[model samples]
Target: MAVVNEGALKKMLKQYKYKDLTVREITNVISQYKDLKPVMDAYVFNDGSSRDLMSLTGTVPVSYRGGLENCL
Candidate 1:
């Protein structure tokens, strides 16, 4: 895992934009945010394609048409 400073992590969370983050990248950020566990565990994907940037900050995504809307 690449070592990222707290500032970088915080900035990512603050201005969340959809990006292709690897599983390790997601885990690194989640390790810093305790409340993000549910979001982390509830979703799974290859290529981290289903990850929602907002969910990293504990923001739950609203379902659209009875399905979770993935950022990708």
Candidate 2:
């Protein structure tokens, strides 16, 4: 599982404070945010499963278009 530091986690919460963001945007934040990059890297390089990552990241699972989707 990816471990998000306190600062990065706070920044992430602030980013989502105003409005809802698309999944793509969330992915972009994970990749682009400097602090979050380490968490993303850990997920990518450590053979971390998507489910595990999502759970750690506080993602909400939803049913959309007859498929499972993630929301935050």
Candidate 3:
């Protein structure tokens, strides 16, 4: 099982509250701090499949704990 970096996620969320980051930005951001797949699924938006990170937002990450970039 993958682990959730709550500290990193929390920091990303705080950043989101201040500004909007693009999917690429978010992708790169999380890549620097934690695992990509888990963070995208748990925090960003997703249909449970792989897709360009730029297209998902607002809808997929609806009930997420973190708010960084768009979901994968």
Q: Compare the candidates by lDDT and give the number of the best one.
A: 1
> Can you write out model 2's per-residue Cα lDDT over 1-72, one digit (the tens) per residue?
333354554454443443234334445555544233322322354566532132134455578999977665
Clashing pairs in 2: none
lDDT by residue for model 3 (1-72), tens: 335455554454553543234434555544554434423334344666543222223323333567545353
Candidate 2, superposed: residue stretches over 4 Å from native: 1-57
Which candidate tops TM-score?
1
lDDT of 1 by residue, 1-72 (tens): 324355544455543543335444676665654345423223557767564443444543447999965332
Off by over 4 Å in 1: 1-21, 37-72
In TM-score terms, candidate 2 sits at 0.22
The local distance difference test score of each candidate is 0.48, 0.43, 0.42
Candidate 1: pairs in clash: none
Question: Each model's TM-score?
Answer: 0.26, 0.22, 0.24
Weakest lDDT window of 10 consecutive positions for candidate 2: 34-43
